[model samples]
Target: MTRADAPPRPENAAAWPRLAVVALGLLCLTEAAKLVAFHQAGPMPRASDAGAYWLLGAQVARGDVWMAERPVAYRTPGYPWFLGAVQAVCGHWAWCTAIAVQYAAVWVTTVLTGWWTWRVSARPWLAVLAVLVCVLSAARASHASLLLTETWFTLGLTVCGFLLSRPGALTQSRSTVAIAAAWCLTWLTRPIGAALLPAWLAIWWRDSGVGSGGTRWRAWPPLVLTGVVLAVGLGPWVVRNAVLFGRPSLTVFLGRELWVTTFGPGRPTAGGLPSTPEAEEIIRRASPDGEFTDWGGNWSVSNRLTASGLSDAEADALMARVARQGIAADPLRAGLRFVVRGIDYWRATYLRSLTDYDDLAGTASDVRDGQREWGNRACHRFRRAWLDAAPERNLLVVELSAALALMGLAGLWLAPSRRETALLVTALIAGIALSTAALEYPSYRYRMVLEPALIVCGVSGWPVLIDVIRRGSRTL
Candidate 1:
């Protein structure tokens, strides 16, 4: 329409779109910077995991059981399967393609974050601002560029939040089906993502018209959808374990790991035993057959030893057997150790034992011939540098994260309802609590699902800070 004939658009009408465009640009820049700055993916354990994922993908590519490979067994195939998909698509350029896909995923996730914050707060500028801050943060950038699953899982989580936020958006059978499908995908994306099952159930219960006369018909649709999706996503793994191994299950990776974490002997150290070994031992000794694993217990042992070695598994089993006998022999010490180890899992930095490397000696020659040689050297360098410099690095990131976290805390404090603020916080805390209670302490990345929530809280506080600044200016 001609200017004279057209009505003026509302001022806010185009603001969100403009902000979104800016956010996209910033997301691109941040991702580009990440690709440049930390292109190699710093040192071992991280590199080891990266290599293991690539190895798993390679194994899957060759038609081998992706779940049955070495050193590679610590992780599930969920992520590498995605990586393998990209590799299949890209042929010899698989690594290149994988990195590109991951970069795009990170940007998409960042944009989604901006859009969600804008949608919820209706503050377009604040949304972009949050995206920029997250992208520039070195910690986030480092993780985003890696061959790790954390970024992808985090992206799925961000998208899931965006999807769930739309009230009654999944009411229709088809829509609820899609929601259930998405959750299944999330779980397939990361085992811990199954935690979202409870989260979604909460959403379903909250949104479902359960008490209405037509509730049965209404609920039945979504319930059936959830079942179908869960069955399909998890069914194959179950069938594989059952047919091949004679045990119907979704977590074979956990079974061997639980055995390793408990009864396995580890490198002698000044500490009585590593917390992981100690916990595994406690559980192993407690079990009747000396098997540390108990899938029924929310796969508690599974999660604990997902990354542990055979030795760790053996130690875990032995410890559990000992603990069970000891608990029968003397309940007090076993109970105390569990409590203490659980706290350690919460408070101690889990970096110490990540590269324990109690068993890689057999492959040392092969490792030298493979990419792991350089990776090992890099890891050693990284460890030396990290241990030497971690104090300063820790101080810096801690201070910044803590300050932002406080901003989030204040924003949450000022929210209209205490319960409203508590939802995300409580869910995050519960997840952390479960992780601590069920598994050993992990790296900073385990808490990643909570970062966006924290960012939202911090973003919410911007208005209060602005208002304070405005009042001070007026007085001046």
Candidate 2:
């Protein structure tokens, strides 16, 4: 194909210096903003899962990987182990250091996001816009202060996208290994990483040259190697869970999350633990008051069962059984719930956390009321303006969501005729979003990892959109 008919190419080498300068400037600005946000958020005390991670890190520092009295399979080991390693070197856990590292990871994610967009869309300016979207996203930046997997997972996803978007990445041995390693780390950080496997297989099947003149057997090595890496990366934790519970489970929390989303009041609506009638009966029978507090649902259920003479394994098994039964009993309802959950996941905004100014509060719950009030006001504003009617969601989040969704659609419309790139991107986003929705209520935080891909897609179509607008103006 001639240059004019071929897909748009990335900027020439002469533009590299300018791109580098722009990337560096954005990095510096983001880092500065992170520091300011961190200070404003003020020494955030480890709360909820953050506290659990801290305690687990302390235990790991003392040479015990399973810190809890019982085998803890609820959370994956990646983030806690990361914190443990940092604390081991620093002599104690330091939020400052951890947040700083996450900030740096954010910067890396931003750069890789830009690079991936440029490779796929061949638009240098759009790539810069992708970078800006990532860097300026208040939701993305706020994770720097929270000891969560968002930062690490975002960086992992971005790096994977960048690597796989390279020409011949699926067929090359080195790129295959790099992609495999990145994926393994990603799975360790969050179970959602498994969703990317189908995308990988799709890319490999299309690009690996197996069907043309090559033997099909040649494709097995990379696929096998990736599987082996994943197994090895997650082996030890799986083994521990197997030994402790007599069955290997990726995460015990899956059952709990399913129960909550399928049967409970769902996200942002707190109620008694195990919101299903059957699960509630189980917990109530175990408790003296015939009720369980909503605080720490996972622990509440587990502890109540264990207190009533059930082993940790038994409690988990029971919870899993309860969740499965709930789904099986009403398959149609479950399917409908999944649709609603998917909508909830995408429409969610990080405004509550962004506007939160309760960093100095003694307890995490101390500023919840204020955050809720702010969120309500945001919802009201959106309802009165852009949205004829709006749900109880943040206005900024609603606007951002609408903008990203529109741009992303435009990007897909303007994408090259080659189906491979579009397929891969769609699969990744759909896989993560749908899988999460199927099992749990989608939180904005959980969906944040996909932001890089969204930004790329949103910016990819910007040039096409502008051209159309210009043409229309001239015609007028």
Candidate 3:
């Protein structure tokens, strides 16, 4: 539909109240689920990454932000710092308080997702539907209850999307800076934010009309300004890493991650790595039973290497060298795997069975088991079934994701030639998928940060599909 054919845009006064009500309703439903799930899982905080996060927070609380004994470069300090503040204020109830904070972030993300949809599609109802999709996402809701980076990254991503989608955002200095700041924060939360830079640049270039007639030089300044903003935001962290490790690096674990994903056990053998007997021997000696896994898994070769003799920086460099060798041995296979990983990334999901809760009262396990037995009562079967199902393969997740993917694709195809909004969203998805695949094996949870953009794209396409179906039915 043309601009004139679209529904009237709601003014700020009318929109805020309605949006607020919708957001509150979502928060209520999500909180209810969280209470049930938390009760079911037990009060003890699950230790996957949460343990590391909590430890980092504890360090922060003690005024040791540098984590001198353990380099802070292993993980970014943003989420831990936030958790530290919660720990400081809430004391014994810190985990609970942190969960509450995460839920609030989810609510903010929901609101921004709705607002962005409305702005892009000019359809209020669809925008609301998009908000519902985001709030109801089992994967997203589950993450909010855990101490993880997903919630913060999701909020930052949605806010950034909303800002970039706004008309004249690129030309306006304040909006440009805001966008840059949001993107930088997202990077700090998770390295994936770096991949999103191109999408933002694409939008800015398209909106600014840089090549149409104006001096191409105009494009250079905004890009430079964005770079400077990011550099300034990251300056402290970079400086600390350089001074502490004597090398400039974003994170200490990237090389280790690359090595493990490429050449370690369980690494896809479809693309074989060249036989490097020396490096292979080193890895085998480091790993337990010659197997490699993530930091959380047993026989973590990376951790063993550090414990055995290598400094964090040296171990990282060793892994990087091994990873590069593996990739060099089979670039064709690596390239193919990257593509396959991109496809697998979307199909990934979080399993509820694995969620760990750190229980403060030491009653978490008993309480969880009691709740499970209590839920077995006939009255609770419906809720019990809902909670027990695998979150990644849950019918709701599978169907909704599939619908969004198909419809979002249709929407992009049906969208106007001059309209670059859909294309920009597509670019963001592509950037995320490609960047993620390049760094590590694909997992469902890795894609959580991109959920907001996915929902927006999926919702935008629904109207187009309905229009096509109606037209076909009338003709028939």
Q: Give the TM-scores of the predictions, in the order they appear.
A: 0.66, 0.80, 0.81
Model 3 sits at a Cα RMSD from the real structure of: 6.0
Deviation (Å) of 145 in candidate 3: 1.8
Error of 3 at 387 (Å): 3.3
Candidate 3, residue 331: Cα displacement in angstroms equals 2.7
| Model 2 regions lying over 4 Å from their true place | 1-41, 66-70, 210-214, 266-284, 287-299, 351-357, 361-393, 396-403, 406-410, 465-476
lDDT per residue for candidate 2 within 141-180, as digits (tens), equals 5565566788899888877766776767777777888899
Off by over 4 Å in 3: 1-46, 264-299, 356-385, 389-391, 395-400, 468-476
Candidate 2, position 426, lDDT: 75
lDDT of 2 at 106: 76
Which of candidates 2 and 3 reaches a greater lDDT? 3
For lDDT, candidate 1 versus 3, the one ahead is 3
Candidates, ranked, TM-score = 3, 2, 1
Whole-model lDDT for model 1 versus the true structure? 0.54
